[model samples]
Target: MALWIYRRLPGAGAAPRPVHLAHRIGGAVLLVLSLPIAYHCITAYGVQMDSARVALHSLAGCFFYGAFAAKVLIVRSRHLPGWALPLAGGTLVTLIAILWSSAALWQLAQP
Candidate 1:
């Protein structure tokens, strides 16, 4: 959707149905995939703050869902400004990157 939005300016035509479909499908898939990881993190670790990295990861994990909910609301609402969706989406992507780096990247780097 980001790519589509970026390219869809300055007289670009309306997006095809498949593009919209793909965006919704992708969002659903991502949400489904994230739930398990979130469940495990909350149940197993429960937001530890023993170290800087762990704390950042935990905070990011917690905020990610909130951001997601906000984004969904922005998408559903008609009163919000046009930029709200993209801003919330960008925030979510950044949080996902942070979570990936702090958890997956850190684990991979271990000896």
Candidate 2:
């Protein structure tokens, strides 16, 4: 996927490309880093969903989505390949999950 993105981009034609092995390893690392945070978000504050908590969660969600957007833009501008489709799909799923969970939490937090 990353390769596809890299191939399609323009400026990325000259950028120092990370080796495939390194890319996979880096992806694994990112997955590892995200797991605990996801677990905590779902298990801990997920149940409460109060306005305050939802506000914070929304902020975090914004950050996550924003970063994804920024990364996509950077890769696109650099004419580099990336795991575009999968990353986009994953981001969509994450957004939906968070929004749904937040709604539930908000209901729970309501008087």
Top TM-score model: 1
Cα lDDT over the full model 1: 0.90
Task: Tell me the TM-score of each prediction against the true structure.
Answer: 0.89, 0.39
TM value for model 2? 0.39
Q: Clashing pairs in model 1?
A: none
| lDDT of candidate model 2 versus the reference | 0.60
Candidate 2, 1-111: lDDT as tens digits? 454444655655633445555765775686568768667776765544357757756565555656556654654464545465557646746765676576666778889
Residue runs of model 2 more than 4 Å from their true location after superposition? 1-5, 14-18, 52-111
Model 1 compared with the native: what TM-score?
0.89
Model 1, stretches more than 4 Å misplaced? 5-13
lDDT of 1 by residue, 13-107 (tens): 66777887888889989999999989999999999999999999999999999999999899889998889988999999999999999999999
